[model samples]
Target: MKKFIATLLAFGLVATLGACGAKESETTNPPAATGETGATDTTETTELQTIKVAATPVPHAEILNACVDMMAEKGYKLEVTEYSDYIIPNTAVEDGEEDANFFQHTPYLDQFNTDNGTHLVSVAKIHYEPMGIYPGKSASIEEVPDGGTVAVPNDVTNEARALQLLAAQGLIEIDPEAGLNATPKDITSNPKNLEFTELEAAMLPNTVEEFDLNVINSNFAMAAGLNPATDALASEGADSEGAQTYANVLVVKEGNEDNEAVKALIECLTSDETRAFIEETYGGAVVPVF
Candidate 1:
């Protein structure tokens, strides 16, 4: 009986050793980490390489925030920094703190580049805020009393645009050649003898009630509940020189024009979804490029 028990025990040990050998052979070529199945771990690590952008509060940042998902598909992240002031965004992009910025027109961007020696360039045209000529106490352009005040933005470039808009309306005539540089002094014909009140752009809406007529920027008009398409007595044509020159642009430092992340952002701005958002949300005050 003892001999038979020893024989069974030895056979059991041999079987156990065979089973362990087979298990080791199966795992000899372990599965490779193709960086695919571990998608969660890959995403958690790659999500850290986000591209930062600076934008204004109105539509720039708002529009960019809507594109986060589209960027993620390309393994990129977008971070938008809202800036209320116009000057800082450009500066931020130039300093490399921001990868790109939105909120200025081609003219403004060109001027900023020229004045500051920053090589910022427009990557895409996003939208344009139409300039509107709103009615004031004078009621009508035909009845403007002599020396009646006409309010315009005081900033250099905008003041010029206001004058051109007035020129387009036949309220005044400017030297056709003066272009965006045309100042109040560039007016060659003013049949109404309308006195011009130059105030900060933001103040134009409030000053309208006090002036004969006010040429308010679309931003301020929207804030004051004035719709360019509905409330303005006159407005710039969609294809006017103003539209081409002052179309709000997405900007990046000169060499970054070819950046893949920036290209994605440009694609986002020019997308159909962004176009619909601009049209539906801003009425005619903001027109989409695409």
Candidate 2:
């Protein structure tokens, strides 16, 4: 009987040892269940990089800011710096302080690049701000009396566009040789003998009451609560050369055209939400080119 009790106690001791071994194994190498390591939950795995850009306040920055969520999905952050003047934004991008800029059109960019010797190039044409003729004194092109003064943007390219739109309405005629660069000097026929007043583009809206008619850019017009589609006496054709060639663009230093971040921003800007925002917010003042 004593021998039998000894064997039973030995078996109990072995069983206890086995249980301890199993507990150690479990503690040392625990099994991964749902939502454990090596799973597809990206909560702690993926992080996004940030991309900075410079833009004008009126629409460029606002448009870009609208794409934040879209860009985030692609693992990028869009930081937009609003610039008041035209020169600083491009300069900032050229100096690598900004990844890109979206304020100027292709023609303006081309001219700026030529003038400043900057190596900037347009990657995508996003939208165009239509040039419109607004009424202050004259309700229509025909109503303007002879020798009445018309206010136009004093810039070379903008003035040309204004003159072209006026010519399209048959209110005046310009020299065919002048092309997009048409100026007051290019006006060959002026039956009304109306005088043209040149003013800074940004100030055109504020000084609208000072002139019989104001040829204003879409941005300034919008700020002045004038909708180009509904309020303008006349506007540039939607398919005009100015609309296409001067379409606002995403610009970067020439060599960075193929940059991954810049390409992603282009994709985001041309996205559905961005297009919808431009159409709805600008109310046809800004047309998407993509």
CA shift of 122, model 2, Å: 0.6
Top candidate on lDDT is 2
Using alpha carbons, what is the TM-score of model 1?
A: 0.80
Q: lDDT for each of the candidates? A: 0.83, 0.86
Clashing pairs in 1: none
At residue 71, candidate 2 shows an lDDT of 89
CA lDDT for candidate 2: 0.86
lDDT of 1 by residue, 1-290 (tens): 99999999999999999999989975784555567864323223544358899987766777788788777876788899987567889999999999999888888788778888998998888889888889999777676787878999887788889999888878889988888988889899988787898887767777778998899878667766778888988888888888777888889998999998888777877888878888788777798876
Q: State every prediction's TM-score relative to the real structure.
A: 0.80, 0.83
TM-score, prediction 2:
0.83
Best candidate, TM-score-wise? 2
Tens-digit per-residue lDDT, 1-290, candidate 2: 99999999999999999999999997787665567666443245567898999987778888999999888889898888987667888999899999899888877788788888999988998999988999878787778998888999887778888999888888789999997889999999999888999987878989888778889888777766778889999888888867766788899987998889888898889988899999998878899988
